[model samples]
Target: MAATPNIYGILAEFETPADAMHAAEKVRDTGFRKWDVFTPYPVHGMDKAMGLKNSKVGWFSFIGGVTGYTSGMVMIWWMNAVDYPIPIGGKPMFSPFGAFPPCYELTILLGAFGALFGMLFMNRLPRLHHPLLKHRRFALATHDRYFIVIETTDPKYSENETRKLLESVGSKRIELVEE
Candidate 1:
């Protein structure tokens, strides 16, 4: 007999955001790390229910802004003081005031880039497809449904136990999603 196909995860459909939020809380309490909740609209407190922490994207933007500002200052200092120094009206070759505008512009530019790239990296985005996207019922998630998916790769995942947990949390339908 052919072996069963690899499973991506267990998908549990829920009828309401409250139901999905409660399911997420239960799953979080169960200590399953590789799981997510989906809903048609943003649900307040879902992040707390999912046990998520504050995002690190701000750090990325801060680092990028610092780098940009430093580079801008260094470039201005080098160009004015070292590359082709010309004493004009006894003015300083490099002035922070003179560099401030360009440095600020660069900081904003690089900070925006950092936020964009960090979000993409953190989300693992630019993907052409996902197995969940192919699941027939998953399309309803954008319309009027809520979903909770626990990945098979999660250390706490056990087919029978996970299914039971989801059922206990009031999932309307439960199915295994194949990889």
Candidate 2:
């Protein structure tokens, strides 16, 4: 017998955002974690349905901001006090008040960079292609369809059972996505 084809996942198409959201809740309750939902437009409460937690991007930004501020302050102090020992009209060479503007600017710059890079990293973006992109009907996802995909990598995934689950959850159409 020939070997079975490798598959990326099972794709279920829903007629409406509510149907997709409800199916997501079912999928979550069924304990299948390796899944994603795609919609033509944003759906409120979808994150809760997908069981996702708060993002760590903010933490990345905070760390970047702190590093920038510390580095800015240290560089200013080292240049003014340790390196040149500048004495300007009896003013302290390394006063923090004098360094606040540059420090704040650096903090904002690095924090913005952190947020941008962190978002891209977290989303695994810059991808050129995905298996789902080959699905003929998937192009409609940007117009009017909503899709839910459950990857075969999920521990709970079984072809027959996943198909049945999607059917029971009111999927209008279901198609297998090959890798």
Candidate 3:
């Protein structure tokens, strides 16, 4: 059989956050969509440079909160009034007012769950492996280096053109990361 192709992407290393940020902006402007930047620390303008939009995790939390509140209210009403109708201490079988506290608690509970799970799912967490993890020099991402990866999967990706683009953006080191 022919040799298997193992290319994953082009990984560009920059000497500083500013270089990475500038490279990100150039990548974004060049219409390459499926790329990412990794830095040892959060870079202030990286999100803007990458043209990333705000995350939708809050929407997931909101939906979970609403569902939890509605479910709590309905459960209370059903158990106290419709199902058992137990009157206690001259109180009404189902007091909408009394249900508010539990509903609020459940709302908070599920909202927390939603936010946690939403973030995990959105970020594709619990990942066991990534191609970048195998790159010999990529470990510096957690310490002192910044990286920009132009994925081969991106629509505009061309190996030679991407290498040239990375060089044009002042990347001092560029490597072809393999899957």
Candidate 4:
């Protein structure tokens, strides 16, 4: 039989999100990357334990909002003043003041789209092929269970050592999930 190329991951189960959080803090302080926690609900202080930084999704949204506003203004400017110039119901040509509402709405639309898409793209979401999928116990994530997983790509990972590490942090159940 041929051996499957493994996508190595470690799953550590905890009885409570609090325990999971403590373990997460220990792991994060160890400077481990490529790790994630799964919980039935959001755990307060979990982000800090996971060492997450402020998201830059808003920055992307801001840029998109600016772009959309500029685009709207430029389009209005070109249509009213330069390209095929026409008066609107005896209104002034190139009436930028009249374009404010639609331009602002479009700015908001673009900003929301940019934020949503930017987060999904940056996080590489919809991960359908994760190694953790192979773990039978992971299904409890959506229920009342809590888990922490670390990828084997980390330089410090080893089979026995990884198991020992999770155990040291008081993980009740430890699994080496492979893809």
- TM-score of each predicted structure versus truth: 0.95, 0.93, 0.94, 0.92
Q: Report the error of model 1 at residue 122, Å.
A: 1.3
* Model 4 C-alpha RMSD to native: 1.7
- In order of TM-score, best first, we have 1, 3, 2, 4
Q: TM-score winner among the candidates?
A: 1
Candidate 2, 115-161: lDDT as tens digits: 99999999898899999999899998999999999999999999999
Q: Candidate 3, clashing residue pairs?
A: none
lDDT, each prediction: 0.94, 0.94, 0.94, 0.87
**Each candidate structure's count of clashing pairs:** 0, 0, 0, 0
Which residues of candidate 2, in runs, are more than 4 Å off? 1-4
Model 1 residue 141 distance off true place after TM-score fit, in angstroms: 1.3
Model 3 is weakest, by summed lDDT over 10 consecutive residues, at: 2-11
